[model samples]
Target: MSSRWLRPEVYPLFAATGVAVGICGFSLIRNITGNPEVRVTKENRAAGVLDNHAEGEKYKENFLRKYVRNKHPEIMPGINKFFTDPKY
Candidate 1:
């Protein structure tokens, strides 16, 4: 609402400050709640476990995917190829 902020000369500064504040806010939030950073040292390089639940469990298709497959099988033929397997 201020006349100074409405001037073209202050537009760049206002935009820059807004962007800087946004970046700082996002950085602070990420630092507080983001996942822990992983350091890939020699000891942990190959020690990481590869989780595979695919073999132990049957893949469950979501209702939307199932509906599309059943009702509109002809729709999006290219994409439907990936879902050709009923188990997918």
Candidate 2:
């Protein structure tokens, strides 16, 4: 028999069904692997500390420094080096 998808009416329905299934599959995968526990822990009051806040800021700064150094190594010779030092 000829292919069912060759019909004009059937193509739209098939495309819509495929899109719906893809969305459902993506949601299921995200729920399984997206680390919901980290979100819950962050929301918990006991886990929030001033040191954690400071460390987060420092981590962001270090990441930016490394990224900038990678993009312009000659200009930022001591960028990543200071973050690696034990003083901080």
Candidate 3:
């Protein structure tokens, strides 16, 4: 039997191919499984943050409407026009 594990030229090709296959397989498995650490908590945290942002926006809009009504009644028409404009 031949002592050489592979022909000198073929060994480097085989090594490089094996490495490429390993990397591809690892990436496939990682994507399929996903990052376990962030799975559950990440979704919950994102939902909570989105809800907080929405609430903050509602508060700001309410404040702006009330301020506009009390301080600058004339601006309300402009505001309404701005919002209702086709460009918007």
TM-score of each: 0.35, 0.37, 0.34
**After superposition, candidate 2 runs with Cα above 4 Å error:** 3-5, 35-88
lDDT of 2 by residue, 1-88 (tens): 4766477778889999999999999767755554233334535546643345554555446545766764754556587667776775
Candidate whose lDDT is highest: 3
CA lDDT of 74 in candidate 2? 58
lDDT of 3 by residue, 1-88 (tens): 4657656888889999999999999877754455322235555546543435564555456544866666644647778978888886
> Between prediction 2 and prediction 3, which has the larger lDDT?
3
lDDT string, candidate 1, 7-69, tens digits: 889889999999999999977775544323332465744666644456223223434566667
Where's the lowest-lDDT run of ten residues in candidate 2? 33-42
Residue 9 error for model 2, in Å? 1.2
* Model 3 error, position 18 (Å): 0.6
C-alpha RMSD of each candidate structure in angstroms: 13.0, 14.4, 19.8
